[model samples]
Target chain A: MVKAVINGIPIEVEEGVTILDAARKAQINIPTLCKHPDLTSSASCGICVVKLKKNNRMFRACCTPIEEGMEIITHDPEIIEIRRTVVELILSNHPNDCLKCGRNNNCELQKLVADFGIREEHFDKFVRDIPKDSSTGTIVLEASKCIKCGRCVDVCQNMQDVWALSFLERGIHTRISPAGDIKLADSPCVRCGQCSEHCPTGAIFEFDETSKVWEGLMDPEKYCVVQIAPAVRVSIGESFGFQPGVNLTKKTYALLRRLGFKAVFDTSFGADVTIMEEASEFVERFVHKKGTLPLITTCCPAWVDFMEKFHPDMIDHFSSCKSPHEIMGVLSKTYFAREKKIDPEKVFMVSIMPCTAKKYEITRTDEMFASGYQDIDVVLTTRELARMVKQAGLDFAQLPEEEPDHVLGDYTGGGVIFGATGGVMEAALRTAYYLVTEKQFPKVEFENVRGLKGVKETSIKIDDTKVNIAIAHGLSNVEYVLNKIREAKKNNQPMPYHFIEVMACPGGCVGGGGQPYGVTDAIRTLRSKGLYAHDDAMKLRCSHDNPFVQKLYNEFLGKPLGKRSHELLHTDYKARPVYRK
Target chain B: METSVVPDIANVVEKWKDKKGNLIMILHEIQNQYGYVPREISFQLSKLLDVPLARIYEVLTFYNYFKLKPPGKYTVSVCMGTACYLKGAPELLEELHHILGIKEGETTKDGMFQLEIVRCLGCCGLAPVVKIGNKIYGGLKRSDIVNLLSQYSKEGAPVAQPV
Candidate 1:
């Protein structure tokens, strides 16, 4: 361990640790715009500059390694001024249209300005003729508000390993955007929202369907059904001024009801169906040698798109099943509509998701309901829905707790965990373990697979068979696993893992692209907490235990992978066009 | 949402009172028909899809890949994957940016070129490759960009239809 003093506070940290990391460990506040925990620290923005008093030297805290007995001045007047000047230069080219921008209070650049008290404009700002790009249909790119901070580029390249964006042009014309300055959609963005998730300004944002959802509420003839993902309950509360880890599913459901949704459904129900279909598919894949060995979960759209567009050879590995939200959407139209006898056409199935990728998932053409209608109508991020709830003048906190409507509402704890990283793997393991052994797991919590680390791998023997499973949340992590897979193939080695679980955004659907814009690592813990809390609070915690799902199989589905089940539940994946460049 | 991926425009309008999913299908139709979603097409489809223009606009801007304008005859894209980026892909894009005099996703003034950057083309071996329509140009250099673009059209003119 290395010992160091930062801002006069002493601390011990691991070797090769940066001064910024050491300062963070000592509870010292060293500001940074270019340093993300998961990114390769570039120290480009120069905002984390600190003076090493002993050596009488200054260095970027993000890149500088902490030495023994090193004394640092983090907030010296000269340092503050230098940092402020750097920020001023960044602001000089940025658009000051904060009020009109979508990321008003949620912008990182704005947050930095707020933190430093740079209220008065110290520099002239430029207004570009470039309007925002909405082509992606899943994100908003208002280049006018960009600070040219390469954090987005860093995350896209170093973290997610997608690298669709870059720093183009130099000097005042300098801009951070996708390659060739082309709109994002025409590229293989996969709509991960990590770039927007890490963007410090409203330059990028999730597509807003609040207005359409509001219209749905006002439509007298439409039966508006809303579904909330498990991660939303924890994160949405923050937008309402609540602290992280505060689970408020009941209140959120009640508030959705107050917002005029005809019926409120929990995405956990769809998650339950996902486990059933997924586990059954796994069984078939093993027993019948059908599909790929160790079928991967397709619940996360970001991962699905990544596999489809970039790794078409691995498409066979992805489970040919719709995500939980899409499954719920189909159920709402086919079953709920038939039950209500309302023209299925009049039912507006609005999915309140925690993912930005859900916006893209609903657009797949090969999926059914294409003969003329979209099954899943619209999607709003948890934050957007909270805004709508507040826009309606309701006190979200004080609203009396209400239960989700029956049937579509109730879900097991296993299903609820589908929102968190490694959740699908754990959920599938919980059921698969029992299905193989016909006995309960000695340990229900698969501690091996759960955590904040982007990727995790484990091998457990189930039913005298070694089941190797891998779970990855962020794109970077998934890329690492794929690289390993390729290396193994090159060496003519046996594939070690049987199943892989990947989410587009780090930490899974709870830490999704469309969630509230608190893109901090802090938000991941909070959202995952919300997901697990909901899981722990639920009565039925196993996929097979959902009585309603059992009834679904007996009365409707007829059995997992049955002709009727395939007709209603399963879907295929397409080898999406790989725009080779 | 009519519980369909693509809904008939007339049926959607007749059921417009609550036809929530019509806009998605309409947007898909527009995107499928054109190489990209043009803003004008979205405006027209908004009425047919029964979606408000502002709402359609919001959806268009949210996703990274959706475009709001006309694309070009031959879409030239560079793979910006990490393997590509480390191998001078960004610099190659800079070269194209200079040669094309337009950023990614924009049509040339004459509507003959559209330059873009995709995530990964799954060609780790050909790190600095560019794709023009279905043709892939491998092992590119900054100097070869102008001549590379000449294959599509003359310096400033649109590529006239071969027919």
Candidate 2:
């Protein structure tokens, strides 16, 4: 234990706890720019300066540990003046066009400047002339706005293991870019958007495509339909005044309808259908030995991109099923268009996703065009939808709840939980158990495969077979799980797992790169809790019990992996160069 | 001829693989051999060391010593230290730039001479010194820049010059 006094207030905390954390425990909030709750502090920004009374030496509270019985002065007139000077220096290099900036009012630096009452430019303005790079078509890199926080670099290289964004050069000339200063589209980016999620400013952000959707909606010849992903329902409420974990599934459907969509479907319905095919594929792979063991999930597009780039050797182990949104897109174009007697060409399918990678996934391959046209015409992120709701002059919190269009709206609890980490494994297991035992899986919930653990390994017994499962979220966690599989293959040992689920973002789609900003693990857990709460409250917990999913299988597609299902709901993977050029 | 001589990148990586700070050390070796770190060599080292190519570029670019492009046959170094600056070094540098048709840190079209403005060469007594390759010509006059450059442009010229 360590006892410390912060700002003359006595406090005690465990040893090795940073002075910033110790002060936080005592309700003393120290201002920080380079420090994030989700990342290690690099102490690049000199904002969190504190003085020790013993020697009167200054220290960065973020990186300096709180010494036992130490007297620390966190905030004072002198410190405030120093902090103000630091902000002024940062502003000198920063652009003055905040009103036109993407981050605008939401930027941390902007907030800090306002808080410090920086009304005048103290230092000479010397903003860099670096041009913006939007070559990825998923995220933009505005180097001029970068404050050298190192958060995006950490998120890209350390957390996601994508190594797309890097700090090149040094000192004042230091700038973040893909290796060799190549276009991000040519780099090993994977279009995950985690870098944008971790970025404190508009230096990195999702590519805004809201105007394209608006143009399509106004076109009289086009029949625009939209669907909301499972994670979008839980985390979208943060943009409004609601709590982090509040479920606004019905309200979002209502909002999309108000925005002039002809039909609003649920991506959870697509998730249920994905479960049907994926579970049956697991049965074929695990029981019949028709395919390789450890069938990996392909629902997260960022994970799909990473697998294609980094781990193409495991392509045979990858499940061929398309993601839920793509399934909904194809169904919206082919089945929904036929049922409503509308022209398929005029049907523009837009998916509201909690992912930037989905923007890339819409046109990943020819399989996305299985409906004879682009299955999904436009993809809006959850953050984009929030902006659209505000732009329409609609009171999102006060909007009346409305149900989705019945054809593809209804979903089971298994489908809704696909938003969280280890969710797909649990959802697939529920249906896979039923397929194997020829009976319903009594205990639908698998608590072992839950939470924000980096890698979760568990096994379930179905009649005679013991199925080993591994669920890994975040791209860095994947390498460990993959190494085990690779080692087993090399050694000619037994298979390590029968099933594996991977989500590129930290806590699956709930913490997606496209979700509301200012996300920490606490927020991720709350958003996940929202989905799990919805799952617990529902009557039909298992995916196979979804009446609409059964109706789709019976009415159009025959069996799980039948000709129509294979054509529309399944896709293939190919090895790709990490660097395009 | 330069393109035909592809040095073994594997041999360089193998030499530094067992050492600490190997990435930076290996990059130094590459810069020493090639006069600049090539993109193809960076890719090869990235695979050999199991490090990301982005990280290698970060190291390559952070240090000003490493160059990304091929250097010319001869380097024209103009000392810009306090002594040299006071002794008409700026005029000498301008004369070289005009004659070579290139600015500091740039090579000429024919790839014969590259211009660079360096700090102190530890020869303050011989202020306004201009060095070309291994030979140093001290107390240089701006008017003598044409004669100095022409002497190096000719092949099989004397490598040493009177200081």
Candidate 3:
């Protein structure tokens, strides 16, 4: 440990700790850019400069380490001017289009300017050119609007463990660019929306597919059938100014009805079906290790794509079960069409989701078209639905709560949990436990597995055979745990997990990239609370209790992982190329 | 271990090559497999594929995702994801930059600490996160990044560049 004085207050910090960290330990706030606690520091912003005791030199606190007897002055007037000057220089090249930008009020640069009371600007704005990059389906980058804070660049390159953005050029010419200066659409961006999700300004914005959905709605000939995912009901309330955990499921259903959708359905019902197929597969794999050892969940398309591209060797580990949205699309077009006595071609199935990856998921060639067309037609984000509600001039909060149409809307708690990080694992467990033990599983909560946190791993013994379950939310966490498993192999140890669930976004669907932006852990917890609250309110908490799935097994699919199940619900994967970097 | 197609580069390598400027995704896949995405395959992707070499090179250089050079045996990518940043990525990133001087996308000359910055990596619970290759060192502090890098010293931690 090194003893250091930060901001004139003497504090003890561990050896090798940076001055910024030391300041943090001493409760001294140091503003910074190109530096994040979650990412490796670059110290490029020079915003965190502080005066060192002996040398009297102001150095970036992020890169400087604490010496045993070093003195640091964090907020000295000279230090303040240095920061203010840096801020001014950044603003000089940055676009001042805050009012119309998406992140206007929430922008970091705006907040910093106000925080520092920096009003004077002298540099010419025409020196640097900023353009909007909209190649990616879900996000746009307005380079001019960026303060070069590198928050977006940091998130894309470091946080997600998917490097899709970087700083191009040097000094004043430095700017963020996607690969090869290509539009985002051409890159392997995955449309996770993390960059926009973290952008301090309107630089990164979500691509609104609302107008297209609205166009289709105005076209009366189109029988638009909307399927709301489990996470949407909880998150949609936020757009309407409701509390985070509030249940707007009924209100959402009613709003969709007023908006002119022909039928309102629950993705939970599809999740129920997914659980049926997944649990049965789990039992077969666990008992026999016959198929993919350590079966990985396929519910998150982002994880599936990642594995396909990078970890194809682990492909067999994933259950071939399609996610609830795709399953619902197929069933709605097929079973629902037959039930309604309508041609499947006439019905358009759309998914209301908390995910941006679903956009790419639907584009996959394997996504079915039971009606002999694309199984799902268009996907709207939770935010997009809220926008459409606003555009329709409807007050979502005032709308009376109502239930979804019968058959497809009815579901269980097991299905609702699919929106959470470990929800899929927990859902699969509810049924897998029963099938594996040949008796009712003791614990229903699976309390060990449920949380809005990142990576969670646990093992349970079923009939004396221990089954390990690992759950990871978001890409970086997933990458870590997966590597741990690989390290175990290198160490000559057997694999640790038997089943793994990976959600591309944080907190699973509740913190989806396409959900409301500005959601923190506190907000994610509120939504997660809504998930469990909704679960507890339900009569059937387990997937096996889903009568529809039972009926499907009794009628369409003979059994789980059966010949029909393989043909309808199962799919394969492909390996992808790594980036040269 | 035999590097069969660099870890994760599967059949879809060809498809990624087909899409112009898809080098970003291709680089991600390659990085996933080999711990560090190599330029050899990236060059191959450009020559045999529709994407122009200049475009591919520019893409590799532009995006933090596409590394134009070989990666060290271990790559430490810190997630400055929004959640992590709100928590503490800025602090973590600072120490890493200082410890390894090549900036966000550059690798150490010794090929030890190939520091990269990735976007959102999903673990808000474990904010201030750093993934050295596939191993995630979560709830990170400045010391943690240094310690993790030091562990690779036998393999090699980057020696600081002389002023």
lDDT per residue for candidate 2 within A302-343, as digits (tens), equals 999999999999999999999999999999988899899999
Chain B, candidate 1: TM-score: 0.77
| Number of the candidate with higher DockQ, 2 or 3 | 2
Give the Å error, residue A192, model 3: 2.2
Question: Which runs in model 2 stand beyond 4 Å of their true positions?
Answer: B1-5, B83-113, B121-163
lDDT string, candidate 2, B1-163, tens digits: 1245477888888888999899999998889998998888888888999999999999998998988778989998999999999999999988988899999878989888889999999998999888888777899899988878887787635444558
Instruction: For model 2, state the Cα shift of residue B64 in Å.
Output: 1.3
Q: Which stretches of candidate 3 lie over 4 Å from their true place?
A: A1-87, A111-121, A126-131, A183-186, A452-454, A479-494, A555-558, A579-581, B1-163
Q: List candidate 1 segments past 4 Å from native.
A: A1-15, A24-27, A54-56, A368-372, A437-439, A483-494, B1-163
How large is the interface RMSD of each prediction?
12.7, 3.6, 9.4
lDDT tens digits by residue: candidate 3, B1-163? 1233443344657667567646677767776766554545655565456453444555555554455566766777888788888878888889888888878767788777777788877766777777776666677667666666776776454443211
Worst 10 residues of 1 chain A by lDDT: A364-373
Per-residue lDDT of A1-581 in model 3, one digit per residue for the tens? Answer: 89978767889978999988888888888997656554567777788888877899778888888799888889978888888988888788777777787676666778778888987896666546756787656677777776666776766655566566666665676667765445666555667776766666677777778877877788867778899999988888877678887878889899999998989999999999899888888887778667866788888877776677657767777788888999888878777887787787778788998877788777675545534678888888887787788778997777888888866888999999888778888888888888777676766788888886678989877888788888887787877778877887789888888889998777788888778767777778889889888998998888888887788778767888887777667667777653433
User: Per model, how much of the real contact set is kept?
Assistant: 0.00, 0.89, 0.18
Pick the DockQ winner.
2
* Residue A206, candidate 3: C-alpha displacement in angstroms: 2.3
